[model samples]
Target: MPGSTDERRAAGYRPLLFSIAYGMTGSVGDAEDLVQDAFLGLTRARQEGTEIVDPKAYLTTAVTRLGINYLRSARVRRETYVGNWLPEPVVLPTDRPGPAEHAELADSLSMAFLVLLEALSPVERAVFMLREVFGYGYAEVARATGKTEANCRQIFARARQRVAAGGQMIAFRSSPPERRAEGEQLARRFFAAAAGGDMNALLGMLAPNVALHVDTGGKAQAFGKPLAGRLPVVRLLLGVFRRAGILGVCLRPAWVNGRPGAVKFDADGSVTGVIELDITDGMVQAIHSVANPDKLAHIRLNPNEA
Candidate 1:
């Protein structure tokens, strides 16, 4: 067995470290890589005879700074991205734990919430996630962010204010399995109407102000901007269905970010794109379609499950 310190550092804290990094970067692969790097850095510090008073604090600080640096580099790339960019979707288990167990984690894991975080600066985003989602105190957040406690508080306040003002605070709670089933049903009905070009049926399921945002990364065909209102979105989707030619294209419903979503598959069964719906009061409020090949690289669509 490994030593006690190794067990504590590697096993006890790895998940929390990953959560922090993911909240910052919104990329599962990048978060895992950053956590691994943090662990390796800790090993190097120990080997070099660096006196560590608190391993948890040291690791948190290292990971936060690393994530901040990574986000700064990533933002430059996003600036040139085609269409309305979205965070890479993360599929969650259908049988999720109760809200009492992982309520905050579930709250922050939604694609909409992650997209909201994109509006913040790197340091501001880090401060907000640490304080709001993880419930870290100002002192701890300050230590992790390498800022004064006052500065950290100011940053968090500013971030909260900006996010609230942006009106992107729609919270996706951890619902019971039956609620998920309802969402899946809604998605099925909507897509069926879309596939059949039933304008009346599709309009009945959409919110009056339903918004559609598609990201193709300039690699595929998509609108240059987001489409607003129900009728236009319905028409655009119908146009898309007509344009796809239907020879080998398939659409399947799956659970995306803990909500019902659909995937586009080629005849050979590879995933080509993903569509996540924000359903509110049994109506689709927003449609997020990501066809960016680079973003879809990590998504695996299971046709047999939702």
Candidate 2:
């Protein structure tokens, strides 16, 4: 029902809406579907002759509520999931420029941050993301979430405490330019060490308490539980890469969820897996690997010479 002007405006807001939805629900497909549903709701409202003073706010609210509902349903499924649950990886080109604002956005999109968010309840996650990540005021968050301003504040406070208790804070602070450069350099060394079977070099780059989490969803082979400690993780990774090498699998350096990572491709050029490294203090703190075919459906890569 929207005219050309209104349609164009709504289209322009798709990126922001997608970000919010994706932050709320760490699944790219769900986020995109929620955004489409929000726009469809807007169309219905306009067709009903309802005047919208601010389409952005309206659509945001719709998407948030929809995401909350979706999470309420998804939480149950996640409980009985086959193996370690992980968000679908968002891969980007390594050469992409990351300014300050972009870095902050990247932090929120990281696999570690999204995994941390799983601790909060649906409304708590929504309130926290609106206030802490997106910088929405209490009143704005209240209107978007259908809660009073005071209640929204309380929810955000509780969410913050929960996140902090998890040993991480959900702040939008960007890493220093030098620190980012160090992470990139470390990631390169990490992949090189693994490929070359340099066990000592790989051990040197990993944190003392480094943890590895692989999500295969019972589709591909992976550990039943999160593997902890430096030596075991290193051993597992080396074995996996060694086997992959025998099968003509290729590893391509990429940016996964804003962190230095890589994508694995099969001999036929199909995506086999994605790996994201959480680097801190110049060491790899966490290794997140996703091999579930369902989650890898969105990742497309051109065939490279094997």
With a 3 Å backbone cut-off (N, CA, C), the pairs that clash in candidate 1 are: none
Candidate 2 residue lDDT tens string, 1-306: 578998998788887787788888888788889989999999989999999999999998999999999999998898999989999887765665433323234656778788889999999999998888888999999999999999998999999999889876633346678877888889889998998888999999999989899999999877798899989988988998898889998888777777889889989889989999988878898999999999989765543421
lDDT of 1 by residue, 1-306 (tens): 236866565556776787788788877678878988998888888778886778788889989999999999998787887778887766544444332212224435667778888889999999998998888999999999989999998999999998888876776557776777788899989888888889999999999999898888889877798899988998898988765546567787766665678788777777788888988789998898888888778755454443
Best by TM-score: 2
Where model 2 places Cα greater than 4 Å from the true spot, the runs are 96-107, 170-173, 303-306
Q: Per-residue lDDT for 67 in model 2?
A: 92
What are the runs in model 1 whose C-alpha is more than 4 Å off?
1-5, 50-55, 93-107, 176-178, 242-245, 301-306
